[model samples]
Target: MDLLKTPAFAAHVESLLKEHHTPGVSIAIVHDDTFSSAAFGKSVISSDAGSEERDCTPDTLFDIASCSKSLTAAAVALLVEDDVNFPNVKWDSKMSDLLPEDFVLEKDEYTRDVTIEDILSHRSGLPSHDSVYMGTKAKRPDTAKSITRKLRHLPLAKPIRSSHMYCNLMFTVATHLIETLTDKTFSEFLQERIFAPLNLTSTFLQPSSVPPADRDSRLACGYSYRESTSTYHAIPVFDTPEDQGAGSIITSVNDYIVYVHALMTHAPPFTQAIQKALVTPRFALPEYNDDRERLQSSTLIGLGWEIFYYRGHRVVQHDGSISGLTSTHFFLPARNFAAVILCNGDAGYPAVAALVRELIDQTLGVEPSQRLDWPEIFTRGRGVRGEAESEDADGEQKNEEEKAPSSIDTAGAKDMAELTLADQPEKERGSEEKYIPPPFPTSDLPLDRFTGEYHHAGYDSFVVGVRASPEGGEALFIDAADRCMGFGIALEFVCRAEAGGDASSPSPSEVKFLAYLTDVDECETEILEAVFVVDGDDRTDAGGKIGKARRLGINLDEDIEGLIWFERV
Candidate 1:
């Protein structure tokens, strides 16, 4: 019996989707060059009960997210071998030389020493400064070149080549490099050298660019599940010009299966050199001993693909997540097997990944007794390691008992905080105990003193201004709509710092304000402290009139302790 066509397999796939609350899924499996495809559930759920739901099909287009990296890596490989156009360029070509004006990192040494392979393999020592770009879609769009230029300001989290840090910004840099080298847009290059040649009709760089005739009808609507209501909410598609090389590919499993098969068989554009470059392990990923170990033995990263050992077979894969979709692509070259799962739900990676793992095991003819029930494990509350880390990131949110000046990552800290804490009561989003100002004496300084534009080169600027508070009073607020976190927040006066309770207690020199960040769904809330340092003193107000603040400190990223001070501009 065909594994993918079996009734038991179909039932398991549907059960996994229901367990994870994913609305729709499309999958394509390739075994020994034979293709099998399946799609289940509605791609677009109609808000009106009378309207017909758009059923997901093999042709339904989805944003493949980071899986696009494989295509970008392939494009670069083609350019490397194009001796007529790029005679001197090689895999180790220095980025500083390729895109000299735009490829500056924090340290001058890194900027000069970094190479094409370094960025492609994610060993450039840069962390995912994703906050710098995540929510900037509503604002003036940033180009790949502009994003690459912004790297000069974001500090590297570790020394170059010390470890593998998955940084999307590096891929964006690759996009810029491709554009600079070929004198064409990244999309143009891919279309000419890869997509068109392969006859991938459903693949496109963006939704708007998808063929107009089929655009609205064939594109899938993305969604995120709201556990509170047990309902799915539509999420806006994440399409940004700045994310081209990093995660901007919109493709269908039908089209992606062709590409993945090409990868497995060393098809045309995917020549021996390209296949070797794409599969050669460049760095060892951090060891994880999670439920995934039941299926795969180990994992490493090559140019844009993650190489893992599933039993004894080598599988190269990548997973991508954006606002409302998650995708996974897997291919085992030795067995001529490949598969892709595309789910149009924000939290669907777990189920989709389990399906892929199961499909791979079946294709390899692994003994049924030895096969792990991945979907069942996920239903039993255990999740894939990568998705668990992504979903639990907000576990680092500051506790209510913590002191003022506590901070969180502005990008996903708020959203992930909500997901991790959703099991908690909703009204407790900002309970009285949680919002209470610290015990320190209130400063007599006027609130106006803290109002100004606080600037961080990496995250741009945060404008602290006066706004109406929830309690019917004027208060200081940070207009963060244009920032990466994508929401504005109100700042409440917390307290003024004091040295000690003894007679030696010195006058306060810093004032704190509590900022409440609510998730987009308003299901939960997280708080951050913003403290401004008083530069000079005026005696009449409180101990003295507070001078203008020149620096504001907020602790960002709980894993990395310390305050991130934004200069008052």
Candidate 2:
């Protein structure tokens, strides 16, 4: 029986496309060590003004996104096999040792002590500071260098290896280290070492590097559905992130089959023993996903894969999502079975839905009585469009504080707000000019040890500590480029009699800062300031593993609520 041409599967696929307005998709399945793939719909819609209606082929290119992590993990494993004489490539070696001599996170000792395994397993205690990797200003191989110096300023989301937060920044760090050790960009190394060996020619690390003819014709364009108009609009593809190691892989199912065979058999030209070791579960993840209210089928993260038991069978998998594409790759080594789905649409939809349906069909003995309504459960992969707040970001609550439109759209302005422990306070949507700053223009207290680099997930690092208040006062002499201050508000503004922002008030440990909706790169015309507060003993704290820094109390900013403890660098 041809399952690919089965009336039930075709009906299901057609129904899903109509329901979500998705344009194209590619599906690949491997069973009994054999592979088959099919692509449906045009790479671009027939109505797209500048694009042609080319049917997606089995070899059509689609951004694999975070699935790149698994491939990268394979690369690391391959290198580990050959690392006998490579002095800087040890899996257990501290990143500080592999990085450039001047690279240092003076305040955080844990940052320097991180191992390669820490990154692959998502235990580096770093959250995604993707703002630095997005948009036109992306930092690539240099991102490793940038983070090393700035990491001291970024607060750890959790203690070293104490928790898993799924960080792309750490993977970028790994890629950079790999580059430094091999003296080549990660893309160059993979091509020579992995892709060439497997003869997978349709895969590329960058869209620009795709064959020029295919780049313009066969590359799938991403789209987002707008509820307001009930239509899909094309979203721009981001081509230059240092995160190529973390999320930027683009390939077709035919080429990916070669990758799958490599995973299953440790395909010749690669070290068999090393590939065998890559799937070993290395880190424990939360056994129960609160949202699912059940133990995760895949509860342990492996070198670049997730290992879990499903229906009494072992499975290894990893999923990827970007603006326009959602993908899933899962394989059961014990059963010699695997399947991959690449959906050219918004986050969740078709890809996950397809994966779930395929898995059930391939694994269980029972046949579905009816086609499953996967969109009903998986919805959009990344987010549900037009919802007040999305509860689908794994478990994070997203509150988007809309910004004035820029010439270019940045990642959702409030996208990562929930990724951190920041507090979300609802405000009426309106212009920033109409809102008031709550009269927090001056401070009477000594700044004390408030001078240092303060880091936040979405906005990158802001300057604080020492003399860098945003309001005109003692920090008035500091250049705008150098001043990052906390604006205390209401009673949080009250300072202790000694520190002196104002006569002793109730929250002695708390301090606030001026936060505004602007870029925070420079002070702009009468722009409203959002208040941020910090709590502390007003003394320099030291003698920790990472290094010398002032340990301040939890700080709260107007747009966000979290205990921000700043480290002086």
Candidate 3:
């Protein structure tokens, strides 16, 4: 007998989504060789009373986030299989040999010695170089190369292969390798190699690449929440074609399971040779990065998977989150079971993992979880995830903090630049004053001089451009593009300020600025701040460019003491 009746399971899923304020969810399961799928809730919902919203269906598209790495790893394995006669690509192949000849990691020799195996398991010693690929204005076509060129200057977070730090850029480099070795764009190669062979027409890297007509009907809307009102607002899908290998692939749970089944059965593209590499453990971490409560001493990471013990049972899986979406792909391969859970909301982050585990445990007749408690944990004032992560390790309490359908609720809910700006408020006939330019910019330093490309010894480059002040006159109109992780920053003002240090030696800095969500045009502002110090003559050029005009040191988080410094090219 099924542990959960179909109707009961659907009801439970809907309950979870509403309780946690996640609008939509999709789950697919392969139990003892039979395939099944369930979806519930609205793909799009509004805090606004009169707004149009939409429902999610079995075919709804989702931004699978880091789960894309599994597909990317599979692509690499196929290349290895295909290269039997040519320059053979092996797991132990040193990355120095694979990198484009022109690229150099000048100071980090340990990095050059990193093997293909290292990258697959997130052991490249590179921490997430978020500022590199996230906010930069660099053309998407040049992102991989620019990141490669800038990589030499970044210092490793840990000794190479010594520990796991969840570096996405390493995968970016791997995708670059795939492109170079195959002489094809990553997209083209993936289409010809993985998607076609698996007959997965719905899976793709970019949302824009999908037909507008089809996307309108199926793509699930992502969302974010504000604590004050406890309301959920829709977020747009990501615009991340630049970091394709790292985190941009989008697909539906239904389509994703087809790929999952192929891997399970060792189907075609995932041959026995590739399966060996795919399942073999590469790097091990102490505990699950996201879930601290579930302690797995032997958490070994595979080429594109995470192998850990759940209830003393071996389970292989991986989880991904960016902006509005969170997803997990997990299963007990030895038991011939697998499941995928995708939620389209930032608020859904913590619950996805738990739901996957509980469902599997109940199906397999294993010890059931005592309490999923997503609402008790993530609901506003109940101790949001951010608060939990920051809580004292000794134990304490705190709390705080999307998508589609099945028998669950289906909600109802567009483009690039217009969507990002949010509100799209038309100019009322009487408001000409809104267009007036401000006089005199903010900041004690010469603001015009900061515009240029800047490089950090251990991260990607940032381009500084000038814009008009949004709030008022006398504030500098400045926009600094972070090329590392595509984080959003809306230029507001530049000013002289100091934090820490006594009156005798106040640190010079720029005022706190707003970072926007890349996916949503009218994103809810989190009020995150960054403090940057500009330096000039004292900096040297490791970057191949000359006459660059800026030196910036930015502090992203308030609690951590680490500061990232960048020199103008």
What is residue 59's positional error in candidate 3, in angstroms? 1.2
Ranking by lDDT: 1, 3, 2
Report lDDT (CA) for all predictions: 0.70, 0.55, 0.61
lDDT by residue for model 2 (311-421), tens = 566777777766556677778777777777777776345446445545654565545653344455455333332110122113233333332223323232222211110
Question: For residues 204-238, could you state the per-residue lDDT of candidate 1 as single tens digits?
Answer: 99766887777668888777787655766665454
Candidate 1 to truth, TM: 0.84
Off by over 4 Å in 2: 46-49, 100-108, 134-144, 147-149, 287-298, 367-376, 379-569
The best candidate by TM-score is: 1
Q: Which wins on lDDT, candidate 1 or candidate 2? A: 1
Mind sharing the TM-score for model 3?
0.75
- In lDDT terms, how accurate is model 3? 0.61
Best by lDDT: 1
